[model samples]
Target: MKPQVILFDLDDTLTESKQKVSDEMAQVFSRLLENNKAAIVSGAKFEQQLNQFINFLPKDSNLKNFFSFPQNATECMTFDGKIWAKEYSFSLSNEEITEITNALNKVLEETKIIENEISYGERIENRGAQITFSALGQEAPVSAKKTWDPDQIKRRDLQKRLEEIIPQYEIVIGGMTSIDITKKGINKTKAVNWLSEKLDLPVSSMLYIGDSLFPGGNDAIVIQTGIPVMETKNPKQTTGIIDSFLKENVV
Candidate 1:
């Protein structure tokens, strides 16, 4: 049976990291939204979500069925016909932010991963609800991000270190080279539960698509909700999955 709603991870799953959605993927996604509720949950900030995914959709697409759960679902935005409105947002306190940044810096220093000469843009970004540490820097090229941690070994090591330092926060590997830190319970599982109540649907009625569903990956948290999931290697695989859903006329 087709899922009543589809949940997706933004980067890598729907589009290449930090890149805009392709025209082909946009068309298919628009069609998916025509009859099914869909949501994007990512560790990225809301602006990155818009620039990379939402802005590429066709004008006539069903915005009402679209939802944005940025910052690893620490924040949620829903379309209200006229505009996207924030449904709820969880923010880190000043002290929490300071501690997280300081811990990240300590980890970087201990790991000796910071290469100032090759790094691009900000290495640490405070997204209000979440803090992210991008090993290759936020503005690193897509190719660089991909090669930086293909096996996720390097990131797993960093994640382990961060966890040891800030056990109070939620820390997980995100995107190609980013590690996302959120409030203790503010992870993708929260998004799944929120949608289940908001849509008045059972968890089994939803299907989640993501690239990072493996152990220690950010998307792994959703597994606790018991939502069915499809794992993809990249955007191309995600497009194919969407195509199959459309072909099957699965809403």
Candidate 2:
């Protein structure tokens, strides 16, 4: 089961919440490259995640790859810091974005959550085509976010309710409080499967590391395709799982 390719989830798996890769995580990635190249599969925009981890990884390794901008992002590169093959992204009109934002804004005003809701990260992202709804604004506190949607029950309910009002949009739960709204095909599973096919690897040969795998979690659908999944309890523990997978398969 030696992985020809290893894919990592950016947030909470390789790094702390809404933070850059830690020195310790960097070391693990370095180890991964010694035998097999690794790729990052994330819901963040392609440029955003790359900006976060590029400094940590060796730029000379052409084997390194990344899959970013989940749903709307379609480019997969061979570590040139650029993509060779870009899958198409579904986009929404400016009016659509404005309307959605306005609705969410109204909700925020009514609930008065905006005052207490400290934005820890980036939200309202335009991945060339898809749109996101990041609760902590992409930089929110993990403890606060957990408190925001303890079981993701609230988010799921919100998604269903939103769909009733805006049936035209496709809403998918993201790595954090964010929600990805795009065309029907915009999902991490499709992106991962596409990358696997392009790499000539099977779903089983590749292990996907992600934090949000619970019901209505973003990475949950990615697991639905029969891909072998390595669930990460925390970023600090990711190295251990990666080590075990590498040892179990490579050794």
Candidate 3:
């Protein structure tokens, strides 16, 4: 059956981590809005998604059919041709934000990982609804980020420690070198539920695509919704999948 809504992960699944969406992928993605309501559900903030992907889409693309779920779905926004309008946000309070960042700093200090490694920029970023810790720094080159935690061993360890320190928050590995933290139950699955309900589509009528659907990855939580899922290795594979979906379902 053809999906009524198609959701995507913004990083490696849609484009290279932190890289701008290429014209090829943007064209394919624009075609998706021709048939289905599409959304980019990612751990990055809206600004990141705007710069990386939305800005590359064709001017004729159907903006109303597109949704943005950034900060691991803690925030939702939709485009209106002129600007993005917020649908909702699970913003953190100042006290909660301070506590989370303090815990992150303590973990980094005790682990000595950040101290031993050569750093680039601010490692911890506050994204209103979520706090992200980039193990290699946010502005690090893709080559450096890719090599930092290919197998996710280091991040898993950090996650375990962070979980213990901040049990109230949700912690998961995201992108190539970042760990994302949001309120418990406000992960990607929340966005899935919201999008499904907002569109009046059942879980069976939606499809999710991501590189990190495996257990412990950031996108893993989405599988709990029981929506049909397709795993892609990279943006190239994602483009091919979109092309095939359109071809098979063409009217």
Cα lDDT of model 3 by residue, 84-156, tens digit: 8999999999999999999999988888877767667879999999999998787989888878888999888
Q: Which stretches of candidate 2 lie over 4 Å from their true place?
A: 62-78, 81-88, 93-99, 102-123, 245-251
Candidate 1's residue-wise lDDT over 91-182, tens digit each? 99999999999999998889887655377888899999999988877899888777888888987888899889899998888877888898
In the predicted model 2, the residue pairs found to clash are 74-87, 120-139, 120-140, 121-137, 121-138, 121-139, 121-140, 122-137, 122-138
Q: How much does candidate 3 score in TM-score?
A: 0.96
> CA shift at 143, candidate 3, in angstroms?
1.1
Q: In candidate 2, what are the lDDT values of residues 1-251, reduced to their tens digit?
A: 56666667777888876577877777667666766757776766666666677566655544434444444334454444454445455567788777666655655455454466678656566665567777778666677776776666656765776676566766777765777776555566765677678778788887777887777666787777788877888888898877675676553
lDDT of 1 at 70: 92
Provide the global lDDT of candidate 1 against the true structure: 0.89
**Considering TM-score, where higher is better, how would the candidates rank from best to worst?**
3, 1, 2
The worst-scoring run of ten residues by lDDT in candidate 2 lies at 64-73
What are the lDDT scores of the predictions, listed in order?
A: 0.89, 0.66, 0.89
Q: Is candidate 2 or candidate 3 better by TM-score?
A: 3
RMSD of each: 1.8, 3.3, 1.2
Q: Candidate 1 or 2, higher lDDT?
A: 1
